[model samples]
Target: MKEKWESYPSSIRLLAIAAIIFSTGMACIWPLVTIYIHDYLGKPLTVAGFLLLLNQGAFLIGSVAGGMLFDRWGKMRTIILSSAGIIAMSTSLGFTDDFTLYTIFFLLNGLFYGTLSPVINALAVVLWPEGGRKGLNMIYVAQNAGVAAGSALGGVLASVSFAWTFFGNAITQVIVLVLFAVMLPRYVKSLALKPQSPEMPAQEAGKAEMLLSQPAPAKKVVWGALLMLCAGLLISWIVYVQWTTVLSAYMQSLGISLRQYSFLWTINGGLILFGQPLIAWVISRFARTLKAQMLLGSYVFVLSMLILSQTTSYTGFVAAMFVMTLGEMLVWPAVPAVAAEYTPEGQEGFIQGLVSGTGSAGRMLGPLLGAFIFQTFQAEGLLYIMAGLALLSVLFFALHSSFQKGSHRVPVQTAEKL
Candidate 1:
């Protein structure tokens, strides 16, 4: 772990830290949105639901818009503007009491929040072009850490006053905004002055570098590959989110306590934070290619679904959760890393935005779909159907791989370490 941390450039490390801080702030709002709307504002559950939908939809639009702006407006400027927007909206939310005004601020907050992710991802890829999945993986870990931290902190803050949660969120973002202003401008200037080479020698190249060594695919082909990759990602997220939605209710129906169900997430977060070294070692040794690692993850997802279908005991559910977490670790980071590899020279932010937006869309759709299936067919049926959905994602990935024409194998000795 120390070796990997040291291997990353200072820029990549800063980006990961920024992700942690930024995500921590955002995470504080997500868990409380429904409760705040329904309980405090005297709104109906359906109204809360509709507002959540609007927030997500706005975020999706913001993601794409942010990407376009990144390509046009420059990276540092785009990031600062996005951060400013988040700060403004979140600060307004802290003081606003009217539900109508609160809803407007929430949607704007989602919009500005959406812009940050793609730019950060595109920045990571550019900052550490030779790091393969490691750079993005580091960001992923940091975001999860932020989520865990923010969730716990938010719970405590809400106990005192709900206003505190928004204030706390805004405070974190303000720190991030300052950090970006002070630390990131130099990095972005360096990027402008020192453009990345599109190709590298095979003897020292990693997956990202090796892909860069190939002839740049035409714009249309790049979009096609991205679409295929996004299709798989969309399905993968849909299958993965069941653990929080239908699967949660199903476990409680089976007499598992809510505390135990919640503990499963605790286990999930703990393992992700602590288990990376071993997972990194395994990947470095065996699944060296991005495609291979993601395929392995997809299989693991299938295994998790199968395990869920047959299990009623708490122990069985725990085992399934473990498997599911492992699967996500492989697939989630790899998708964007792979997309980074194929991104056109001027379109990095746009490509990453599409990937982020697609995942957002899946997240928005997953609960509704999962709930419908669980209601219509029950637990076992939902499991089998989701397993099939996971399998379908595999086919999408395979199709994506096929789209990479003229690809060739490079020697193992040439590859960079994970």
Candidate 2:
């Protein structure tokens, strides 16, 4: 197994590494951008909140569209085009001052950025067709590591200048684009000789082609899972998004400085980086059942939020985040793997889009939800809401499992009847 991984083409490996670096830069800018809007640009908190929500909304649309495009046009082309779009968007962001213009530009950015998640996952699967669960975990580790680095660096850089942060992200995108262009040809060629699946008959092939050429179906198990996941994800994100919103206010209430605010995010990212890979390894060894993992993880996640509600000190807050990260490490990777398993063959891109779109929905709702709760009843209310949602998710997941088992047993029972 090790030899097989070691023998993966240099070009593919390079692309994966470049993808990680590019994502790192992208992730780093998010917290900084919010800070810039609120602190540097003199925008109202509500406006900043709207901008954040808009970005995720655009991403949701883009994720679904990008998935369809990837299925039709192929993963390499989709990635290249999306990267070019991101480069333009990120660079232009540094130059804009108008809140409206920035909002529009970020919307565009989200549109293109949405393509990255599904394309990267699909590519990883293609690269390690035999690796299955193990391959997915590796991809998750790579993704989270990039995110961890980006969030940590972005927080520190925001303290410097938001423009510098944007510029830094643009530079990474350019590097990734150039590397992809140079190496993609060899990567494609290396994979081309893998035996193709048996072709359909000419008439059937035409029909299959026509079906793919049309818009994707709305109904799919992946879509169902996406919706189910979104309910839980939104609750968690509502809490997490506070780090960009009222958490600063909460810290101020506690006599903490802006530097301390940045440090909190940096700490969050650091813990995620250190914890995710280890969690992945542990999950691979012990939690062979994704359903069980998600159930237990969700329970732990809710407990962390409940802990957050009672935290009066920075240390206590950080400890809550640490517990949350443990749950996240188990849940995040398992989500994609479970979604992929539920997806029908030939619809990888579509299923992945659903996954991304669901996540986007959570992100879109997170800030607003956080803001609303904080305004209405303060930080403690936010945790109560999250805990309630998490409990609801546990119920939903249980029902989903029962449904799945019933569906599977029906055919066996019918066979016995026959």
Candidate 3:
């Protein structure tokens, strides 16, 4: 196992480690924000939602900027700069008992952290160009492992004082920054000016052949499919973002403590961590197509939200979360992997930026929309809204799937033309 692990590229491991550390710190704060704003600061739920919208809006811009930076500045600089920014934000947040300061720093944190996310993902693709969707899943699992760690810690610390969560986030990110500064530059320098391996030519050639062989109609179909997938992904993100927003408030209203609320996120992270590899195995063995796996997962999302609407207890919430986790395990990584399949040469990071941006847009919308429904219509209304979003996502994904089927069929003459 050690030998096999060592055989993987250094960049792959570094990116995975960065993902874990970054996401761990991020998870510590996100769930705490809504609770902190409403419970501790005595702000309205709408205020919390607006704050998150600010954060996510900044995040959206950062994601797009980060992709351009990843392409221009390269991995080492991108990682270091973003890491330093996060340290600054986290340090400020630790001492920020004031609402205005917290909101500003929080928004800055999202922007910086958004810059960080794409760099990690882009580096993964660069390092493992041939590993396909499976490689993305492995990185996704690493991130979820961090989420599990952070969520569990956040729950325990929030029980004591929410300040601890902020402090802890800073500490973890600082450690990550130190590791990157010490290790990454040298690793990158070692990779510099190296010639491509002989086998890579054949692999790249095969990829070109695959792309060239696709019928024009198929290419157009795939482009349409990508647009539809992005739409569905945005809808799904709106629902998923609620786990940290309105859902937290709703669950707590039923007598669930802060710790329990945090634990639910922990459960989500654990399932994603342990479940992704298993889901990948099943998809490879059975689903046979990325779209098929995605569609199947979307249906599960619909069911999870429906179940969530009727939940009246912690136990019921847990059950709903489990179902939601299953859907996430299936869908989350697949989106990027699907986007990767459509990416052209010299534009890898940019395409991924679009994918990340769509998700952020949905997340930006989620808190505001969720808070409105939660505050105006109450808990029952929020559930209905959740279900409706899930169904909308399903419709979009189904359209993508329909187009994908058209792409799969090739004329005999077209095959011969290749």
Off by over 4 Å in 1: 195-216, 406-418
- Candidate that beats the other on TM-score, 1 or 2, i.e. the better one: 1
RMSD after Cα superposition, model 1? 5.5
Q: Record all residue pairs in model 1 with backbone atoms less than 3 Å apart, i.e. clashing.
A: none
- Where is model 3 more than 4 Å wrong at Cα? 1-8, 35-45, 95-98, 154-164, 181-225, 248-263, 309-315, 371-385, 401-418
- Could you say which candidate leads in TM-score? 1
Clashes of each: 0, 1, 0
Candidate 3: tens digits of C-alpha lDDT, residues 310-339: 778889889989988888888888888777
Better of 2 and 3 by lDDT: 3
Q: What is the Å distance of residue 32 in model 2 from its true position?
A: 1.9
Question: TM-score of predicted model 3?
Answer: 0.79
Residue pairs in candidate 3 whose N, alpha carbon or C atoms collide under 3 angstroms: none
Error of 3 at 104 (Å): 2.5
* Candidate number of the best lDDT: 1
Put down candidate 2 lDDT per residue, 1-418, tens digits, no spaces: 4574466555446645776787788887875666688887898867777777778888888888887776677666887788888888888888888877788778898888887657766555555555455566566656666777777778677678787778778788888777767765556566665433465578876875665566534444345555666555555555555656666688789987778666766665676656655665766776668877777777877888788788878787777777777777766666666666555444567667766777788777766777788899887887788777777766655545433331110001111000
After superposing candidate 2 on the true structure, give the runs of residues whose Cα lies further than 4 Å from its correct spot: 1-12, 151-162, 182-192, 196-226, 276-286, 402-418
In model 3, how large is the Cα lDDT of residue 83?
A: 84
Which tens-of-lDDT digit does each residue in 3-71 have in candidate 1?
Answer: 877888999888888889988898898888889998999899889878887888888888998888887
